[model samples]
Target: MNCYECVQQGRSEVAVAVCYVCGAAVCVDHVRAESKLLRGPASPGKVIRDWPARQLTCPVCRAAEESP
Candidate 1:
């Protein structure tokens, strides 16, 4: 599929990733990599300190999540 961000700029590049939050198709250039600490189904503090984590995000979601 075409990239959501590239389409906005009148370009059409192949989508390399999908935004986890918005499900928007994005190309490598539009993709934002982030580290997300995940919690397991086990009791709160019982989970591993560095369990499965991190994911790709889109520009829009990244901006909304950025610190002020």
Candidate 2:
């Protein structure tokens, strides 16, 4: 699987986002805002970091945390 956020394909543009939980790059689809307003009820906004760690994250992992 490929990163869903920025261009993280095989050393192309450099992985813009990397999943904190999985330690993988996240492209547009994988990366998401951590704010409730921006992400809605599904996903909340996380603290924006300076690097990929803050940008990418595993949706499955995040969803597990969201579950009650």
lDDT of 1 at 36: 74
- Clashing residue pairs in all predictions, respectively, total 0, 12
lDDT of the candidates, in the order given: 0.88, 0.53
What pairs collide in candidate 1?
Answer: none
Off by over 4 Å in 1: 43-49
In candidate 2, what are the lDDT values of residues 1-68, reduced to their tens digit? Answer: 45543333343333446666777666555565463323323336655433222333567667876799
Candidate achieving the largest TM-score: 1
Q: On residues 1-68, what C-alpha lDDT tens digit does candidate 1 reach at each position?
A: 99999999999899999999999999999998877787656676684455767699999999988958
